[model samples]
Structures are given as structure tokens and as C-alpha cells.
Target chain A: MALTDFSAEEQIAAVVAGETSSVELVAAHLARVEHDEWNSFLAVDRERALARAKEIDGLATRPPLAGVPIAIKDALSTRDLVTTAGSKMLEGFRPIYTATCVARLEAAGAVIIGKTNMDEFAMGSSTENSAYGPTLNPWDLTRVPGGSSGGSASSVAARQVPWSLGSDTGGSIRQPAALCGIVGMKPTYGAISRYGLIAFASSLDQVGPFARTVRDAALLLSHMVGRDPMDATSLEWTEPIRVPSATRLDGVRVGVIEELMSDGIEPGVRAACQSTIDMVEALGGTVVPIALPHAGYGLATYYLIAPAEASANLARFDGIRYGHRTADADVLLEHYERTRAEGFGPEVKRRIMLGTFALSSGYYDAYYGQAQRVRTLIMRDFAEAFAQVDVVASPTSPSTAFRLGERTADPLSMYLSDICTIPISLAGLPSLSIPCGLSEGLPVGLQLAGPAFSENRLLEVAHALELAIGFDDAPQGVGV
Target chain B: MIDDAITRHVARLARLGLTEDEVVRMQHELSAILEYVDQVQGLELADIVPTTHAIPLSNVLREDVPTPSVSAELALREGPNVTADGFTVPRMG
Candidate 1:
């Protein structure tokens, strides 16, 4: 059987049953990643990975995820691998320590197969902004995998890894998962530690998982969720969530956000959402249409708040520290110019400029402060909607994955692709994207969002829907 | 509310040296986006508290423990220019 054919749980079972060793599993995955042409990885540290696998294989006591292979998003720091953040700025910069999330995964006995590609500094929705190259959707090589977590999402969707980690600033995890046709979850903002994640917009940045199934996503999430001393903003939720069994969706009330559906949804995308809604209702769950008044301006609020925070968080990369430095500079001003000019990509530079402009002295009140007030309104809207329903359902993106360079020329159009998923992210709620159906042979996702810290509940609903609407396991090339 | 003057000032704060043409381009683009965002001012939010983060967060801090780092020699290895004890660079003034 193909290694990717097994779910994350089954892989662990294989390790536990003495059918294989951790090194063998790691070797198999590395081989698959090499032969696979998705360009999902930026750096694959085979020697270090095989060495770690041998060490884990010697363990007498197996952890829950022993020997399972997973990919790390390039944005996080890993001592064994170069933490590039998909930009030339940190090209050779090796972090002294591992990210808390990566450390936690390592402790749980999972193997770090490689570092995946992303938009430079996690700035774009598609991976086209990577200084290296774009990550193509495994389903359709001509098309983009959803991004800046595109590499992580596409790897799992292509059956290259059982599960992988991705960071979400504004729908980075869920958006790509939808585009790649896999299960992805962005936990409540502070639920996972952000210690080693290179800050894009610190306030909104979060680490999440992309998996082949809801249960697998939850299993990885449970391992990664906890407060860490390194990240001051991390939260401590004392209650341990039990993974819901197959029958947990009874009497659940799911609210469909009215504004998201009417805005820019394509015809096939709408049908898939309605099909999921019908499945929810058939299973004795109630589905209702609800209005989020502030959601109409969600994109606007995100641009302001995220960039303002980014402008502050990114100031530390000004060449005085340990990142890319320029040559032939006799003076400080010349050094700053050469370093940044060579380091950052067009998208990152654009955002830094826009954020700097927004937070400048005279414009601060009108742009940044006004954006915050509107954020309050958006949060209130979610609060009111949750009062009437247990979860909200929608298409993860307005349309399926587009071709590479399709929207690269227009940055605004690319940013608008995140419209539907950005609101839930802004509210710091838990959301999951599961493969619902196909549109024009490309995969679309059904986005299920629940109240804060309700990851288990959200996964339970996704599990129920997965059973209702089965997904095709056929690789795109085989049938085509 | 934003114009070429504001763009120049913001660029300076960002430490970006933009030419006159780049300044004009950014001014028009930022102006268009800011005008769209101005719609947020329509809401009266006197009663609401502004939120900086989505979740209520508590700072997780470790005890101030001294940790060992790489020796200065190794730290400055990647530096283009190195001093006897540290990294050397262009003069600040």
C-alpha cells in the first residue's frame, strides 16, 4: 500500500504494531517528496531527519504520534533546518532554538520531514510571492495551491505527508486547505504558542494544522495547544477536550453567515455549501441564515489592523540584527537601503509601506483607530450570531484555486480572495476547512466555524459531514 | 486625508527612499484604499472598547534566567565585516 494512502492515525498504528520503524517511515516520506513534483518543500534535511528517526525508533515507550512524518511551515524556526520564511532576507539564518510548536511535535515522536514553501513573509494568498517559486496545487499542477501555507496544505492534499503545520495570519491555513482539498484548522488565536513563528502580524498570527481528516487534525492540535513562556500572548485553557465520536452532531445549531454567501460566491461553490447545509439538516442539526452587519467591512478592517501590527513587528529586521545584510555600504543609510532592497519581496515591501502609512502621525486616528473600532463591531456581530447558533457554515473561499499568476498582477484582487474566511479569523474563532465537493475538477472546502476554544466541537461536525459527503482519493493525474 | 506629503513622511519613517514617481504612485493608491476605509468612521463607537487581539491573552513569562549563547566569534561569522570582539559595520554618524 502507498504510505500516503494511510491516515495519520493508521501510520501511528503501523509504528505501534511493530510493522515498521520510524526511520523507515521517514525514509519513505522523504523519497515520496523527492519524486513528487508539487514543489511543496523549500528545504528537505534528509540526513538530519533520518538521524532523528533512528533516535525515535530506539524509544521503548511510543508516544501517541511515534514515527509519523509531518511538514513544518517555513515561517517557524527549526534548528536542524534553515528558517527562511520564504524570503531572501533570512536565506542562511539558522535559529539557535526550535519553535515551541516544533519542539512539542518533536517530543510527541513525530518526524520533521522538511520545511515547506510560503509567500514571502506570509504576505500573499497564493504562493506566487515566494522568492523561490510558487507551490502548485497537487490536484491541478497548472493551478496554485492556496497560500501562504500553500506548501503545507498541498503536501498533505497530494498525500505527501500525513499531516503538517501551517500558520494563519488571515486565513493562511484554512484558505489553502480549501484550495488544496484537505482538512485544515486554525485554532483560537492564543490556543497555540507563536514563539518561533517569524511575526507577520503578531496580533493575528496563529499556528494551525493541515491534515487528511478531522480526527487527525484534532490529534495534532491537542499535542500543540498550550501556553508557552516564550510567547506572552499565549492562553491557558485548562479544560482538556475529548474528541467527539461519530454521533456528536445531534441537536447542533449551525448558522450560515448571510453576507458571505451573497457577496462573490461562484455557482458551483454555492451548490457545495448548500449540499453541506442539507447534510447538516438531514442529520437532525438545525441550519439558519444569520446576518453579520460588520462582516461587510471585514477585509477593510483586516488590512488596517494586520498591517499596523506588521509595521511594528517587522521593524526588528532592519539589518542591525542577524538577518540578510548588504555589501559595499560605507554609511548607515546606505546599508539600510541595500539590505532591505535586496531582502524583501514586492508584496512584503508594499505591506510595510501601507502599514507605515496607516500608522503615521496624522493618519493614525482615521485609519488605525477607526479600524479597531470596526473590529469591535465585527466581534460583536460574531457574539450575536453565536448566541443563535452553535457554529457558522460557508465556503472557505468564494471560488476554487486559480491558476498561477492569474491574480498576481492585481494585489487587491488576490487579497479579496480571503474575504469569506478573514472575518472568523479576525474574531479569533476556531474554524475548519474540509473537502466538501469539486468544482470544475478543483476541490472546494466547507468552512465550519465555532465559538472560541470549540475546536473539538468543530471537528465533530466536520467528522459527521465527512461521513455524509465522501471525498475522492483519486490523484488528479490518474483519472485525467 | 493622505497626499504626497504624508506619503513622503511615512516613507521616511519606514526608512524607504522613494523617488518622486514612486511617491506619486503610492499616494494615489493609498488614498484610494484609505477612502474606502473611511467608511468605518460612520459607526459611533463611544461605548465600545477597542480590541487589539482576538482572544483575551495573558503574558507567559519565564523567570529571568541567564542562558548561554554562541560565542561572539561564531555569532559574527556570518557578518560581512567582523571586529576583534564583535561584528564591525558602517559608522552610525
Candidate 2:
């Protein structure tokens, strides 16, 4: 059977039923990673992964997710593997301990296949920003897979794993998932522990899951979630809720944001979104046009606040702690300068400087403070709209995947690509992106967004949508 | 509009010493970006609460457990140099 043909649940069932040992599953996945070397991982820790899988096979009773093969985003720390954040700055840096999420997944018997590539420091809209080579869209190989979490999304979409974890700040996870034609969830901020995930924009970053199916995404999330002492922002424990596949959209009020739809949206993408809404309506869900008056400011607020936080979080990579160091500097200033100059890529430095400027004492009020106030308004807009609806719906992106390097010359254009998805992240709401339908031979995503702690509801609705469309994984034979 | 002054200031704060040519290019690019952000300024958002993140949590924390870390050799493997149980680097002063 094709490696991309198995689901995470199926893999687990196979392991449990003794049809395949944990070591076998790990070896299969590792071989697949090796075979598709160009599209996914930044690094493959075959020895470490195989060793762990062998250990798991020896266990008597496996956990709920025992022996399931999984991939971690390069952004997350792993004791046995190098956590490079897809940046040269930490090219060979190994963490002392596993990140909380990775540890939890391991405890559940999930095998860590390898770390996938991403935008450097999770900073770009496309994986092209990676210090390592950009991850190709498994579906096309010529077009982008969507970004930051692009590799994770593509890996799962191509069935390299049943599911992979990704980090969403702005639309990192959702946009890539949308573009790659998979299910990606950015649960309520702090829904999962961020203890081991390298900090990008501390305030905005949330670790999420990418899967071939909505339930699979939910299952992966369940194993990795719950509060962690290391991450003050992780969600508190709650009884695991299995999102029934029978969920119907009937009587669920969904608000379709008017601001998300404008002339700029491609014709095919807009049509797909309309079809999704029609599907929702056919299922008895009410679609209302809601105004997110503050959503217009989401990109602006994110640019300011994310950078400010990034400036601070990235300050720790001073060549003396945890990451790459330079030995050629003759003085302290030279040491710091040379290390950073040689370590960080252009985009990372660009953001750090922008953030430093925004937070500088003289400009703080005009930049970061104003952005924070704007964030307040954006959150309030969601609060008001949710009073009238259980969820909000929108296209995950305005257009389908563009050719590689298409927007590299224009940063603002790249930033605008995330417009529809950023507002949900800014408000700290739980949102899901599922493959709604294809547009112009490329997949377009339908976003289902709900209020805080509404992950179960989001998943249920996503599962319902999945049933309505009967969407299946179809990465083969797609063009850029 | 963004100009050389803004680029210089931002670069200084970011600790990047960009050349004049790069500064000129960045100034033009940032000016375009600021113009895009200007669109948000037109919205009448007097009472809305600014949104920061998508998830909300009061205290998702970890236990105060200090675990043993990997050996220093492993931690510093990626570094360019290491000595005396520490990563060696150019002098800060």
C-alpha cells in the first residue's frame, strides 16, 4: 500500500491489531520520507526514530495513540533530533529536553517520524523563507504548498503521515492547509502547550494539527493538548470529547464575514466559497453576513505585535545560548554582530528590526501600543458577531497557490495573502480549515471559526462539512 | 512615506547595518507597506477590543520540575566552537 494512503487512526489500529509493529510503521514512514526527500523534512533522525519505535513495540498495552507515526514541525524542540526552526541560526542545535507537546505525543505512543521544513522562524507566508530549501507542494511540486506549516500540511496531505503538528501565527497553519487541501486546526490560544515550540511571535503563535481528515486532526490534538506548567498559556484539561461524525449543521448559525469577500478574491475561489455556504444552508445552517469592523486592522495589528514579540523572543539567540555561535569575533559587539549576521536570514532580521523599532521607547505608543488597542477592537468585533452565530465562515485564502517566487519580491502582497485567516487568529478563536472543493484545479479551503474553547464544535462542524462534500484526499494528478 | 530616516532607525534598533543602497530599497518597500496598513486606519473602530491571539487561557502552565538536560557536548554540537563547558564566541566588548 502507498505510504500516503494510511490514516493516523488506521496506522494505530494496525499496530494494535499486530498487523504491523511500531518499528515496521516507523521504518515505513522513514523510508517514505527518504523517497520523497524533496517535498518534506528539513532533517531525518532515522536512528533516533527507529530506536523509539522499537521501544514502543516492546510495550504490552499501547496508549490511545500508540505506535501512530507522526511528524513534528521544525519549530518544535526534540531532545533526540535537531530543532532548527528551518533557520541556519540553529542549524545543529539540539534541545536538552523534548517540548511538552512532543513529550505528550510520545507518551501516547506516537512515533516521531522526522521534523518537517518551514518558513524560517515561522515568519513567511511561503516555505521559501526557509534557510533550508523550500518544501514543494506534494500535489504539484511546482507551486507552493502554502506556508510556515506548508511542509507539515503537504506531508500529511500526501499521506506521508496520518497527521502532522504545525504552528499557526497569522495563517501559517490554516493557509497552508487550505492551499494543500487538508484539514488544519488552530485551536484556541493555549489549547496546547507551547513549552517546547520555539517562540516566534509569542503572543500570536499557537501549535495546531494538520490531517487528512477532521477527526484525525481532532484525535492528534486531543493527545497533545492540556495545560502544561511550562506553558502558562496552554488549555486546562477537560474530558476528551469525541466529535461524532453524525454532526449536522442544522440550526447552527454561521456568520459569513462581509469583509472577507471583496473584488480581489479570485473567481474560482469565490465560487468554491459560495458552494460551501450553499452546502451549509442546504444542511439547515443559517448564513448571515456579519461585519467584523475591526478585521480590517488585523493585518496591521499582527505586523506590529508579532514583530515586537519576535524581537524579544529572538534576542536569546546571541551565539552564547542554545543555538549557533561564531568564533571569529574579536570583541563582544563583534561576536554578537557576526553571529546574528551569519546566523539569521534576511526575513528574520527584517522582522526583528521592525519589531525593535515598534517597541522602542519613543515609538512604542505609536506602534505596539496602538496595535494592541486595535487588537482589542478586533477581538470585540468577534465577540459581538458570535453573539448572533455559533461560528463564522470564510475562504481560507483569497486565491489558489501561486507559482514559486511569484510574490517574493513584494512583501506586502505576501502579507495580504493571509488576510481572511488572520482575523480569526487575532481574536484567539478556535478555527478549522478543511478542503471545501477545488478551484481551477487547485484546492481551496473553507474556514469554520468558533469562539474560544469551541474546538469540539469546530471539529463537529468540520466533520459535518466533510460528510456533506464527502471530500477525500486527492493529491495525485493535481497541477500547479 | 517611509524614507531613509525610518530605515536607518529601524536598522539600528534591529542591529543590522544595511548599506545605503539597501536602505533606499527598503524605504520604498516599507512605504508601500505602511500605505497598505493605512487602509485599517479608515475603519471607525471606536469600541472594539484589539484581538491578540486566537486562543484564550488563564493559566496553562507546567509543573516546576527541573529535569536533567542533555550533555553540554550535545547541546553545543551545532555551535561553531565550544570550550570550558561553554560555547566560545567572539569577545562582546
Candidate 3:
């Protein structure tokens, strides 16, 4: 079998069994990345990856991910590689320190093959906002890979790499993974340290992993999660979730969220997700009807709250600190204005303005305050739902991968793409998207979410469902 | 709908510059978004407490031990204009 054909775990096994060397694996992935057709990777660290692979080849016993090639979203800092976060503002800015999650991945023996593309500053639902241009879907070249983790999802789907890391502020990881027909997990907030991650919306952002299989995602998450002094919000390390190879859903109570299934969902997507629920029933799991009453307001609430946080978090990028600066300004204020205006894309600027307006003196109580209260209500909705169910199931997105430039003209339409995944982020729950089936020849993602720190149960349930669904649809003719 | 004055003010606060056409477009878009978000005003939130964070966290303090930090040279390496001592920005008005 081709090296790219092996699962990440199988690749590690191959290295351990002396059937394949780490150098061979890394070189194969690097070559694929170099000749990528999906525009997935932003920077390929060929030398560093080969050097690391060589070192691993010399080791008598390999680490868990000893020879596996992993692509990183440009959002995460790498000490040597440039971390652009898909924006031109920090186009060539190389970090002095690596993100804690990445540091852990390196220590686990994973080869950092390259950095993937994303929506600029992780802002948009489609990667068109990226200064580097949009990443095309491997399944359909005209369709988007989704964002702001589009490149990571597309890279994995295209088989440029077996697995990759993506950051989710508000469905950035899961939405893209769903579009790409892969598995992506957004752990509970604080599950992974965010030290070297350039802040977008501090309260909402969580680093996650994207892989072809649920088990691979679990493995990646296990290596990445731990507490850190640098990130006070980091959660204490929990025992890694072990997904049984033979997955069974007996006694698993799957909650069917009435709000998530409401109107605007495409007909095919609804059918695919409903079938997955039926499979859960056949596997002896009970499907309970649950209500997230405030879920209707999630889109609006997220728009206000996330942007409000982003407005404050992004204030640090005033051109003097780091990143792009304007050359034509003669005074400090003009310089600040020119730098930001020239650097940020329309979506980023729009959010900043909306956030500033909402948080302004007279409007804070009306916009920002109202959103926070609604957020509490949304959290309560989840708490109440989980009382009757072990996990909540929904379509990861309202529709499958949209054609590129389809929704870019209308901001509201773009925001609606995340309606299904936003509430979980607001509630700080662990959620993952796994391919259930196809919608109009495109992959449909079945989202599974649980209360905070319930990643173990969530992953187990998702694995069982993935096995039952047996979705092995790979994008055709994508790799080298 | 938000007026051009308010939109411009917000842009200033955000440190972003807008053209005349952008201001008009932003005013309309912001107004529409605000109208949608105004749905929250209809909810009976008198008994609801606002949530600043999803997971409740208190003041997280770390030990006051000195740890290695990025060197000054490395920190300023990405700056647009840097001198030996610090980053150089345009002169203040």
C-alpha cells in the first residue's frame, strides 16, 4: 500500500515494526504538500520535518506518534516556522516560541510537516477572507473547504497529511471538517493550552485536531491536552480517552436537539443526520427529544459576544508591537488607523466595528450585556438537555460545503453556516463532527456534543456512530 | 438604522478607517445585524444572570518565580520599525 494509504496509527506501527522509516513518511507527505492542488498548506517545513524524522529513525523505541506527519493550522505558533494565521498582517512573522499544544506534539514524536491556511485571523465561515486566497474543497474544486480552519481540513481530506491541528473559536474546526468529510474535535474550553496561539476571541477559542477517523482525533487530542502555567485557563490533564476498536452504542442516550433540526437545514443534510440517529437506535441507544430554548438566539449572541471579545483581544495589534505597519502615515493616530485598515480584511474590520459599537458607552447594556445574559440561558439549555441524555446529536452544519464565493456577498448568510455549531462553543462543551454520510454527493457531518470535560464519552459515542455509519468516502484524485 | 456619524465613530473607536461608500454600507449592515440581535430584548431576562465565561474560573494566579521569557531582540524581530532599544512608531501629534 502507498504510504499515504495508511492510517496515522498504522503508520506509527509501520515505523515501529521497521517496515517503513520516519524519513520516508515525512518525505512522502512533504512532496504531496509541495504539489498540493487544494491550496491547503501555507508553509511546508521540509528541512525541520526531515531532520526530525531522521532523529526518530535513529531511536531504538519510538514515541506514540514517532514518525507520523501532522499539519498545523497557521494560527498556532511554531518556533522556527512562520505562523501567519492566514492574514497578511503577520505575513512573515515567525514566533520566538511554539504554542504549548505544538510543543507537546513535537515531544510526542510527531513530525511537523507544514502550516495550513485559514480565514484571516480565524474570522470568516469561508476561507475567502484569507489574504492568501481560499482553499478549494478536495471533493469539489469549486466548493469551499470551510473556515477558518479550511486549509487544515482540506489538507487532511486531500491526504496531504494524515492529521492536522485546527483552532475553533466558533465552529472553525468542526465546520471545516464537516465540509471536508473528516473528523474534527473541539475539546472543552481550557482542555488544551493556548499560550502561543494568537488571540482572536480569547473566551471562545479552543485548539483542536482534525483526522480521518475518530480514533486518530482522540490520539491527537490526548497528546495535546494538559495544564500550563502560561495559560491559566488550561485544564488539568485528564486520562486519555481510549476508543474501543469494536464500538457499541448500548445504553447510550442520544439527545435529538429540536432547535438544531429546525428550518433552514438542507433536506439532504437532514436526511443523512436522521439516518445516523436511526443507526444509533438500531444499536440499542435511546433517542430522547431535547430542547435548547435559547439556541435560536445563538447566532446573534455569538456575533456580539465573540466580536466584543475580539475587539478587546485584537487591540494589541496596533502596528507598533508586531505585524504589518503602514509607511505613509506621519502621525501616531493616522499610523494606527492606516496600519489596521490596510492589514485587516473586510470581515475582520466589520466584526471590530460591530464589537466596538456594541461595547461602546451607551450600547454595552443593550448589545453586549444582552448577549451575555442570553449566553447564560443557552448554557442552561444545555445543562437541562444533558440531564436526560448522555450526548447531543445534530447536523454539524446546516448544509454541506458551499461553492466558493457563494455566501461572501452576504454576511448574514455566511454567519448562518455556523448556526448548528455555535451554541456548543458558547456552552464550553466538547463537541466533534464525524462523517455520517453524503448530502448531494458531498459529506454530511454528524455532530456529537457533551457537557464540559465529557470528551471521553463524546469520543466513544462518536467512534461507535462512525463505525456504524461506515463512511469511507475519500476525495477522489487529491494526493500526489 | 445607524447613522453615518455613529458608524464613523465606531470605526474610529476600532482604529479602522472607512471610505464614504464603506461608511454607508457599514451603517446598513450594522443596522441589520443590530435589528436581528434585538430579538434578545424580547426575552424576559429579569431573572437571568449574565455569563461572562462558560466555565466558571476565579482569579488564576501563578507562582511568582522568574521564568525564561522571550529575549527583547526576539520579541522585536517582527516589528515594522525597530531600533536598538525599542519599536519606532510615527511621531505623536
Candidate 4:
């Protein structure tokens, strides 16, 4: 098998065991990056990646991820790399500081080959929202890979890089990971530092890893997570996430969220989820029906809360500092207005308007405030469910990869794409999307979530279930 | 439907310069989304505390001591028209 085809853990092991040089491994992966064929990468500086790999090859002693190649979503700053966050507003904006997650990964000896594409400001559920272009699903080129982490997810799925980092505000990581047929995780809120990530909704955004296997995803996450003094919300994780040695899930309680499964789910997705439950039972894990009564309102609450936060977070894009400056502005206020008006796209504008109205003087209490209360209720529902079960199961996305331009016309239809994953983001919990099996030649993800800081337990259940399901990660012999 | 006046007002608040064509479009879009999201107002849970952050956190305060940091030139490198160690912006008339 090609070095690019090996799991990230296996690639790292090959380098550590002197089976393959870092340069060779990186070169093999770079060859698979396909020169803008997938629209997955914003920048693929082969020269820089090769030079970095050579540096790792010459090291006196090997580092943990010595010679491993990974891609980062453009939302995270990378010091010298231009991070557009998939928006033309900040087209050539290069940050001087690197995010805490990127810094930690680099310090542990990983080579960043490129920055992946994403939806503008992490707003939309499809990479079609990207100003540059949408990232195609590697599984089927006509379909979208999902967003705002589509590029990152597709890159990992295509084996351009064995693993990558992506941020999930509301299912960006998990949905794309599901659509693209790979393992993606959204760790507990504040479990990983958000210091350098371009802020969307501060409370909802989380950076996590995408990998070919759950263990590899866990390994990459373990390297990236820790408290950052820069991000006050970041917490020091006390528990060690170990690669589970046991292959069977014994006495694990998997709570199936009834609300998520009932309405608007595709039949193939439902069949795959039911099969997952049966497989869990086969592996000694019991399934319990969980009722999250308030989950029906998660979409409504999220639309208000996320956009309200986004309006505030995105207000920094005025022409004065960085980002696009309009040529027609005569004064400061015109500059701010015209710059933002011209720079932001339609979806962004709609969201800004929605958020501005919601937070406006007379409407704040009825919308944003009420949404926060509903958020509290949703969190309480999860708290009640977690009390009975160690982990909860749902479909990461309602369906597999949708065709490009399928949901773009109607904003509400596009928003519904994230129905299954949005509630988990609202409550600020750890969740993972691992491929269960194929549904009509497409991958379907079975989502597993746990309460705050229960990633180790979630991983334990996921890893064991993964082995039992024996999912074929390949999509019609597509990549590496 | 959300009125044109309200839609324009919200657009102004957002500092977004929408064209008249866009104003009409945004009015319809905003009305539909707002109508949908207005479901939150139906809940009678005023007593429930709002969650600002996912995890409960106590503020960590420290001495406001100056630390070594990035140089002004490097920090403003991405800013438009950096001159004399500061950003150049249009003057308010």
C-alpha cells in the first residue's frame, strides 16, 4: 500500500520505525493532493511542506508525530499563512499569531501541508458557501463534502492527508466527516483552545480532528488539546485519552435520541442507525430510548443564538484595520458600511440582518434572550439523558452527501441539514461521527455523544463499535 | 411579513449596505427565518438561567503586567496603509 494510504498512526509508526523517511511519506501524500482537483485546499505550498519534512528527517531525535502530514482548516491562524476563513472579505489577511491548537500540533512534530477551504465565517452547512468554491465530495465528485469544514473533511477522506483539523460550530466537523466517510470529532467545548480560530459563535465553535480511524482521530486530538492562557474558556484536561485495547464494548449503555431519529430522516440513514443499535447489542452494549423533549426547538434556538453571536463576532471586518476596503467610501462610516456590504456574501448578509434584528432594542428579549433560555433547557435535557446512559447515539447528518447546489436556494432547507448535530453543539458536549456503513453507495455516520469531558468514554464506545461494524472506509475505490 | 422599513433599519444596524433589490430580498428572507425562530418566544421558561458559556467558569484574574509581545510592524502588517507605525484611515469630516 502507498504511504499516503496508511492510517495517520501507521504513517507515524512507519517513520518512527525507520520504515519510511518523513520526506518520502510527505511527498507521497503531496502527490495525492491533486493540484486543486478537489477544491479541498486553499494553499498547497509543496516547497514549504517538503522543506519542513526534510527538517523533521534531520532531527536528532524523533518527535511523537515526526513526519506526519496534516491539513488545517483556514479558520485557524497559522502565523504566516493567509487565513481567509473561506471569505473574500479577508482575502489576503495573514495572521501574525498561530492558534494554540496549531502551535501544539507543530511542537509535537507534524507537518502542515496546506490550509483547507470552509464556508464563509463558518456560517453554512455546505462548502458551497465558500467564496473561493465548494469542496467536492471525494466519495462522489458531484456531491458536496459538507461544510464549514468540508475542505478539511474531504482532504482527510481523499487521503490527501491522513488526518486534518476542523472546527465545528454546529456540525461542521461531524456532518462533513459523515458525508465524506471518515471519523470526525467535536470535543467538549473548551477542551481544545480556540485562541487563534477565527470566531464564529464563540460559545459554539470547537476545533477537533478528522482521521481515517477513531484511534487516529483521538491521537491527533490528544496532541492538540490542553488549556491555553490565551483562550480563557480553554480548560486543562485531566483525563488521558488512551487508544482502547479492548475490542468489545461490555456493559456500555448507548442512549438513542428518539427526537433526532423520528422526523425528516432518510430511510437508508434510519436503517443504518438501527443496524448500529443491533451491532451494539451484539457487542454487549444495551440501547435505551432517550427522549429530549426540547430538542425539537434546537434549530430555532441555534439560528438565533449563532447568528446573534456571529453578527457581533463578524463586526470586526470594518475597512479600517484588515479585510476588504471599499473604493467608494468617502468617510469612516461609509467605509465601514460599504466595506462590509460589498465584502460579505448573501448568506452572510442575511445572517447579519437576522442577528441585528434579533438583538435590536425591542426584540432582544423575544429572540436572543429566549433562545439562550431554550439553550439552557436543551442542556438540561441532555443532563437528564446522560444521567441514565453513558453515551447517546444519533445520525451525524440527516442524510449522506447532498448534490452540490441542492439546498442553497432555500436557507431554511440548508439549515435543516444540520438538524441532527446542532442540539449537541448547543449543550457544549463531546461528540464524534464515525462511519457505520454505506447507504446506497454513500457513507452514513453514526454519531456518539457524551457529557462534558467524557470523551474517553465516548471514544471507548466508538472504537469498540467501529471494530464490530467493520466499516469499509473506501468510497468506490476513490482515494489513496 | 417584516416591513421594508424594519428590514432597512436592521441592515443599517448591521452596517451592511444592501441595494434596494437586496432590501426587498432580505425582507422576505428575514421574515421567513424570524417567523421560524420566533418559536423560542413560545417557551415559558423565564426562570431558567441563560447559559453564556458551555462550562461554568470563575474569572481568572492576574496582575496586569506588560509581557513581551509581537512588534507593532508585524501586527499591523495585514492592516491597510500602515505608516508611521499606525493604521491609515479616512478622516471623519
Predicted structure with the largest lDDT when compared to the true one: 3
Pairs of residues clashing in candidate 1: none
Model 4 Cα lDDT, one tens digit per residue, A150-205: 99999988889999999999999999999998999999999999999999999999
Q: In terms of docking quality, how is candidate 3 classified? A: high
Off by over 4 Å in 3: A244-246
Worst 10 residues of 2 chain A by lDDT: A471-480
lDDT of 3 by residue, B47-84 (tens): 88999888888889988998788789888888888999
Could you say which candidate leads in DockQ? 3
Q: State the lDDT at A455 in candidate 4.
A: 88
The TM-score, computed over Cα atoms with residue i paired to residue i, of candidate 1 is 0.96
lDDT of each: 0.85, 0.81, 0.90, 0.89
| RMSD for each of the candidates | 2.0, 2.7, 1.2, 1.2
Q: How many residue pairs clash in each candidate?
A: 0, 26, 0, 0
Error of 3 at A74 (Å): 0.8
**Candidate 1 positional error at A184, Å:** 0.7
Worst lDDT run of 10 residues, candidate 3 chain A, spans A237-246
Classified by CAPRI criteria, candidate 4 counts as medium
**What fraction of the reference interface contacts is present in each model, in order?**
0.52, 0.58, 0.81, 0.81
Model 4 misses residue A196 by how many Å?
Answer: 0.6
Reference-based lDDT, residue A362, model 3:
94
Give, for candidate 4 chain A, the lowest lDDT window spanning 10 residues.
A471-480
